[model samples]
Target: MAYAEEYAPTTADPARIGYALVPLLDYFEGKTLMYVRGATCRGYVEWRTSMVRANHANARTEARRTRTVSSATARKELGVLSAAIGFWHREHGPLESVPVVTLPAKPEPKPDVLDRSEMARLLGGALGFYQLEWCDLETRQLHRTLKRDHSAINRHTARFIVIGRYTANRPGATMKLRWMPNTVGGWPDFKRELLYRKGSEVVESKKRQPSVRLGRAALAHFRRWKAIDDRAREDLARRTDGMATSFLCVVHWGGEPIKDIGKSFVTALDFAGLPRHYTPHVLRHTRVTWWVEAGLSLEEVADAAGMTTQMVEEVYWHRSPHFQKRAAEA
Candidate 1:
């Protein structure tokens, strides 16, 4: 718990560490390192997988459902536990041997990439308003309403989608982008047509966020968003006597940076006529898949997508036009 709280803020995805580690503390609180073994690890996995979690799909009704956890999730949690043990050993122990942390076999990758048409629909949905029609049972009349205006409340999500589609950044990195260089988050340099995905002070994590060049479409969106933000800032300053506003490129109408877009993203999925499985992370997969299908070299795609060439080949090479061409020809 102490280690997690100390390092969570420094991680690329603090929420992930927090979520994975907190529950682990409950199960392993009274236990020692010696208590961790193959059987114990398997027992932990079984216990975790048997537990039920809330179903967000029926959140409106405050419904509860029995959603069994996956081995992947258990593995991540145990991985954190393993890391904590290692840290303990390194910092304080000259003790005997380190215990081997048993982990489940890695699951096969199920990369779900969106097609161009689907991406277009998603972007359109993010930029448009919702149209709702329903019958008024009390009045016995049909009514139409336009609510949940994206331009007003969820415009930030549109910017997020555009940047994600072009840069293939993780959702957390996309949300951390600002208009100017800062010590905390990345910024876009419109003049140079590049995106510096991490601040100088930010440490690089396992998931890389290397700087990437911006495409014309992404640059145009950045410029337009900057102009709109500038105007909004000026208006706010005039009204509020120089009140400070967020420098983040993606923000609400009031210029506040959004902390989470889960609900808004779900609304976007619905508007795009996409299934629930289509998530924000799919934008990154879609961009990589598109680059592969377009005949971009593995190295180029890896660098642009902040991934290793090995990972590209392993997970996405099958999407490339040249994947098995030589074999097929032979």
Candidate 2:
């Protein structure tokens, strides 16, 4: 820092450590990291612990009483400070000292996910639900079974579950998906496969920008979903263009994105008899673990699962002989 100051007296330090924790906490809070400190640091653990304990009284379907703040949460919070310090150093040269953070340590385990059978049960259960309003059974010239085919919930949640598993995308990123035709969005070849852009919001903060490629099944589902929406409301579907739908998500009566799906996800999980702690994040871990176990390299798994190679090696399973033997190569 002295050297940097000496060399360029006009330059100011990129970061200032001589301050209370509130401002820094505020700055980091907006980002995706676990940026807990000050009041949040004091309250977060207690609040989470109380949430779990309270659930015990109302634990009808979920065994969420044991869920509480994890060591991983604390680790990430500390890492935020470390990252801030590093960023400052890179911008304004090295600092002699920075704030020292002590993080609580605990045993780290591999992330858990549903098994194949559980996945099937969840999908089947979601598909079984019938949305009477969306399905015009009385007016349609069809039988009972045939008219029940138009389930908006099934298209959204069940298909969402399927796409989430295959792509291993963050739920937010998956929901933000848009399908752009080749001719419209500077893509000259329409036959160049069904490509999905996860959009700038998803990639702006991320280091490795992703090119999301839809699998055959995903492509077919998207196509079918768009067709269904268009068939249901031909006028609204013509808003974007004569091309693909504006979003690759299931919409409501007015084509507005459903703000929350937690309730439906819970019902699906209960139907599948899965652990209550299982969430959409588990899909990422499952995909990474499955790929690693199936002999994909750490980098390969990271690319497919939207994670870093280090994360894949650390959070998935580290004891695999395949990863162990090729540690030097990575």
Scored against the true structure, residue 36 in model 1 reaches a CA lDDT of 87
TM-score, model 2 to reference: 0.60
TM-score for all predictions? 0.87, 0.60
Candidate 2 residue pairs in backbone clash: 182-187
Question: Which run of 10 residues does model 1 get worst, by summed lDDT?
Answer: 54-63
**Model 1: runs farther than 4 Å from truth?**
55-64, 129-153, 247-253
What C-alpha lDDT values do all the predictions have? 0.80, 0.52
Best by lDDT: 1
Can you write out model 2's per-residue Cα lDDT over 68-135, one digit (the tens) per residue?
A: 54555545544545555555666775666554444455456657866676677667656653222344
Provide the RMSD of all predictions against the true structure, rounded to 1 decimal.
4.7, 11.0
Evaluated at residue 267, the lDDT of candidate 1 is 73
Tens digit per residue, CA lDDT, model 1, 1-330 = 656756666767777787888778888889987888999899889988887653443444433354567889899899988877776677667548788889988889889988998887787678675557899899999997655554434677788888889989888888777888976678888788999987777767778888999989888888898888888788878887877565455545358776776777877888766887677899999999999999999999999999999999999999899999999999
What would you estimate as the lDDT of candidate 1? 0.80
